[model samples]
Target: MKSVSYAGLTFETADEIADALLQLAAALGVNERSETVDIPVVEQNGDLSSVQLVIGPASQFISKPVTSPYNEPASAEVVERLTYRTRLLDLPRAAAISDSEIGRLDFDSPA
Candidate 1:
């Protein structure tokens, strides 16, 4: 079996990105346990919610190049590996959204 993961992010910039990702995963029958979802929130006064959520795989795999006599190939599988991770909310320097908005930080598709 192959191991892969998906991440779902939600921000004020757009309402459909997270929803689309969620749809993609569900349409593909992605194992919920394998996917991680994180949504960091900020406030207007440069304050943040005391609660931060981070969910993902236990660990990630590193890729190695394969050299073959006939051809050189990279890892059989891989995805965009993220490093120096952070949320864009910090840059906006906006204050926290309404409590209602905070609770709405889920990827929900419209029927």
Candidate 2:
């Protein structure tokens, strides 16, 4: 388990979930974007609950190790979605142009 501090509150959740959430937050920040996410958490008495967070360029998060006996929350789908969104914001790369294409461009002019 991990303790994730966001907004003004701290919540306990699975290690992987916390790590992925932080990573997604960073990616969004780099792209100057924001997203709302629902994270599953374990309450103090070991009850299951969730927290809604708005993460963006200005959002801050803190995650630390915590000991818990309960099983990690089932959140693989959430992780995958976060990863996909992060990938969508990847820096643009220049497209590769072939020598033949370059030659065509040089000769193709409107008369």
Candidate 3:
């Protein structure tokens, strides 16, 4: 289990979810973007809840390991979604240049 502190409030979630959330936040920060996401978390009373987090370039988070007996919230879908979004944010969206295109450009260039 991991405790993620954001906006002065702490929420507990699975280790993978916490890690994925951090990664997504970094990606969003690098891109100077923001997003609202709902993450499955365990409340202090051991009840399941989905907390909405608004993360962006200025967002700050603190994640730490925590010992909890309650079964880590099953949030594979959340983790997968976060991972996918993080990867999308990290990808460079420029068009790909083929080897032939590069060769043509090289030949057309002045010596």
Candidate 4:
């Protein structure tokens, strides 16, 4: 239960923010070591302290191909067709929280 230190929200509600952070932590697969990191949250449409738990470390993550290696490289047109997910947020679980300042974000969905 770590406290997120950010000044984006107009009003700070520790309980709601904490719950959202915890949910995001599990979805992002954060372990015991990842400290809070800046993440894109759907608030005033800016960055916020979502969580430090990332799918992979920066080095390993940046090296991966857009598509799997076994599969042939995607054509330029095919690559253009790809779009990132933005609405994959879990609503049912998040409903319990009523933090208007924090807003709702599909934290786990690909940016």
- Worst lDDT run of 10 residues, candidate 4, spans 56-65
Ranking by lDDT: 3, 2, 4, 1
Could you give candidate 2's per-residue lDDT for residues 19-57 as a string of tens digits?
889998999898888988888999988889999989999
- On the 0 to 100 scale, the lDDT of residue 64 in model 3 is 98
Candidate that would win on TM-score:
3
Q: Global CA lDDT of candidate 1, please?
A: 0.30
- Which candidate do you rate higher for TM-score, 1 or 4? 4
Residue-level lDDT tens digits of model 4 in 2-89? 2233333321123333344434444444322233333322222222323232321221111111221132222333222211111123
Candidate 1 scores a C-alpha RMSD against the true structure in Å of 20.2
Highest lDDT: give the candidate number.
3
**Stretches of candidate 4 exceeding 4 Å from the true structure:** 1-13, 30-111
Q: Candidate 4, residue 51: CA error in Å?
A: 10
Model 1 stretches astray by more than 4 angstroms: 1-13, 24-33, 42-111
Tell me which of candidates 1 and 4 scores higher on lDDT: 4
Error of 1 at 28 (Å): 6.0
Local distance difference test, candidate 4: 0.30
Count clashing residue pairs per candidate: 6, 0, 0, 0
Candidate 1: tens digits of C-alpha lDDT, residues 28-71: 23232334433222323334322222433332322222222231
TM-score of 2: 0.78
